[model samples]
Target chain A: MQYPEAIAKLIESYSKLPGIGRKSATRLAFYTLGMSDDDVKNFARSLSASKSDLTFCRICGFITSKDDDPCVICSDESRDQSKIFVVENSQDEMAIENTHDYHGLYHVLNGVLSPMEGRGPEDINITSLITRLSDHSEVKEVIIGLDASTEGEATTLYLARLIRPSGIKVTRLARGLSVGTNVDYADQLTLTQAVNGRTEI
Target chain B: MQYPEAIAKLIESYSKLPGIGRKSATRLAFYTLGMSDDDVKNFARSLSASKSDLTFCRICGFITSKDDDPCVICSDESRDQSKIFVVENSQDEMAIENTHDYHGLYHVLNGVLSPMEGRGPEDINITSLITRLSDHSEVKEVIIGLDASTEGEATTLYLARLIRPSGIKVTRLARGLSVGTNVDYADQLTLTQAVNGRTEI
Candidate 1:
C-alpha cells in the first residue's frame, strides 16, 4: 500500500531528526496512523503551540512558559538575584536545576563562541547580557557556566573580559567536568561538583 | 532572553523525535527562529500533509501517493504480476527499489511475526495476503523478502506453510544477509545478492 504524499512528507521530516533514519521515520509515520484524528491534530497543534506559547525571559534569558518580561526566575524573591550563572542554553539550565545545587538565577547565552562555525559573541545574546548586567545594580557575581569545549572556553574568556569592568566577580564552573562535554550531558553528581567548586576568573 | 512559549514548546516537540535528545532539539527549534514565517508554516503543513494524504494500497499493501484503490505497483500492467516480493514495510520496498534489482512487485506485511511482542499472524496483513492468493489465479511465486531476524524467520515459516497449498512457488532471500540484521540496514551488494540468489523453500 502506498502512503499518501503527506505521510511520506511527514516521514521525511521525522527522518531529519538526529539518529532517526528512513526506516524509523516510516515506523513513526505509521504510528501516527494508529492515532485518533483528534490526537494527531493535538500533536500537530502542540508542535506549533510550543513555538508560539513559550518566550525567553528578558532579564536572564531563560526559557519560560510566561512572557511576563522578567520570568519566574528573575521575579522570584527567594532566588539570589545578586549572583547570575551564565549558561550556553536552556538545556544547561535544566541540567543545573536537576542538580539542585545552585540557588542563584541563570543567564542563557543561547550559544557559545565558535569561530569555525562563524559564531561570535554578537551572534548570540552577549550584548543583551552585558546590557542586563550594566542596567541591574544588584547583580554582583557573574558565573560563567558554559560547557568545557573549545567554543565554551572562548566564550567564557570573552565574557569574563567584557564583564570585568563592571566590577562583578566573574567565575566559572570547576575543572571536574571532562573537556568537550556540554553541561546538559553531564551527570547530576558531576554537575553538582562543578557548581559547588566554581572558581574566580 | 527566554524563548517565547511557542518556541520552547516547538523545541520540546522536536526533542521527542528519535535520537534528538534535548540540546539538538533546542538548536533545531532556535534555528527555526531564523526561518521565515512562511517556511515554518510550510514545515508544519508538510508534517500534517504526510499524515492526512497517504493511504495503504489494498492489493499489494505498499504505500503510495495515489488515492486510487490499488497503488501504482498493484495496478501496473506490464510488470511481472506472477512474482510478489514480500517486505516488512514500505521503506523496505524503497530499499529494494534503490538497488534496481527486482522488477516484481511488493507485499508489505507491515511487520514481522513476533510473539514476544504480542504480534501474531493476525496482527499483520497475513489474512489479506491469504485472500489475495486465493482470489488471484495468476500469482506463480511468493517471495519472502523479510528481515533476517528471529521474528522475520518466524514470519517466513508461517507464510511458507500457509501458502504451500496454493500450488505456487514459495521462496526466501538467500542467506546473504547476516543473522539478526534488518534488511533495511543491509548494504546494497548484500541485499542484491540475496534477491538474485533467492532459493525456493
Candidate 2:
C-alpha cells in the first residue's frame, strides 16, 4: 500500500524543503506529475542549474554564475567601494536592494553563528569577508545587516570584534520596532529598544 | 535588483508547486542551493524520474513504473474482481488501502468534475473507466470513493448514471459527521445526514 517508488522518491525530495511535511510533500509530488513534460524537464533543469551552474562569489560570498566568481557587486566600480553591507543571506541583500536605499557593495555571510548547532565562523562565509576587507584598503566601513535574532547578534559581535582591530569603522544594523508594527502589539524587548534608540524628528 | 538568472529560474520552478507563493518559492530555492551537491542531484533525479520513469496504469489509471502498463492492482489475481473502488486520485486509493478494510481493485479518475474549472468527463480518466467496465464482466460493483465536495458528488452522479445501464451496482462513500468530530461543532448538513442515516448499533 505504498506509493510507487518514483513518486515516493519525489515525495521525499519535496519533504526536504522548509515548512513541507509528508502530507504536503505528497500533494506537491502528485501536482508535479500533472505538470506538462516540458515543465517537468524545466523544473528539473532549474533544480540542477541552481546547484551546478551557480557558485559563491570568491570575493563577497554572494551567489553568481559559475564563471563570475567575484560576482558583479564585487567587480562593480560604480558602487560605493568605501562601504560593504554584510548580510546572513542573499535574500536580505535583495530586500535592501529592492528598497534602493543602499548603494554600497555587499558581502553574504551565508549563515549565522549558532553554538547550539555547533556552527562557528569557519562554517559560514565569514573568512571571505575578512579577506575582502584586508585586500581592499579603500573600504572604510563594514555595515552588518544580519537578522535581529540571537544568532545574528552573536555573529555581529564576533565580526565587529574581528574587524575593529584594523581601525576600520564597523556598525551593526539598528534594532528597534519594525516599521508599521503597532506599539501595543510590540514585544517588551522591542519596545525597550525603540524607547532607548528614539531619534528626534 | 533581480536575482541571478539561475536562482530566479529556480524560484519560478518552485513557485509552480501547490500552496507555494513567490516568498515560499524564494525560501525553497535558496534552501535547495544550500543542499549538498549529491542531495541536489538526487532531488533533480527524482523530479525527472517522476515524469520519465513512471506512467499511468492503462486499466486502473493509477501510477506505476513505465514497464507496468496495467499496474499491480488491476493485474492482481488475488484481489476481488467483482468490485472496483473508484477514487479521484492515487492518494485517495492509498488512504483506503491503509485501512485494510477493502480488498478490491481501484480505478483512479485522476480528477473529479469541476465545472468552474472547465474540467468535464473527457478531461478526466472517465472514458477509460467505462472501457474497463465494458471489458470486464466480473465487476459487479463500483464503490465511488471520491471526496464529498461538490465536484466529487458531480463526478459520482455522472459515473453512476453512465454505468447504471450496464446493470452494475454503483455505490458511493457515505456522508456524515466524521469520527472524533464533536456533535456541537458539526455542520448543519453533516448533522442532518448523521440523523437521517442513523442505524441501530
Task: For candidate 2, list the clashing residue pairs, or say none.
Answer: none
Tens-digit per-residue lDDT, B1-201, candidate 1: 345557656766666655667777887776665455555565577666655676778887777664665887778888887888899987888788778778887789988999799998888989998898888778899999898788998899999999988798999976777778799999998899889878789
Give the distance in Å from residue A188's predicted Cα in candidate 2 to where it truly belongs.
2.5
TM-score of chain A of each: 0.81, 0.94
State the TM-score, rounded to 2 decimals, of chain A in model 1: 0.81
* DockQ score of the complex predicted as candidate 2: 0.80
TM-score of each: 0.79, 0.94
RMSD of each: 6.4, 1.8
Error of 2 at A171 (Å): 1.9
User: Model 1's lDDT to the true fold?
Assistant: 0.78
lDDT for each residue of candidate 2 in A30-91, tens digit (9 for 90 to 100)? 99998999888989999889988898887887888898777887788899999999998888
Q: What does the lDDT come to for candidate 2?
A: 0.90
In order, what lDDT does every prediction score? Answer: 0.78, 0.90
Off by over 4 Å in 1: A1-4, A18-24, A34-39, A177-201, B1-39, B177-201
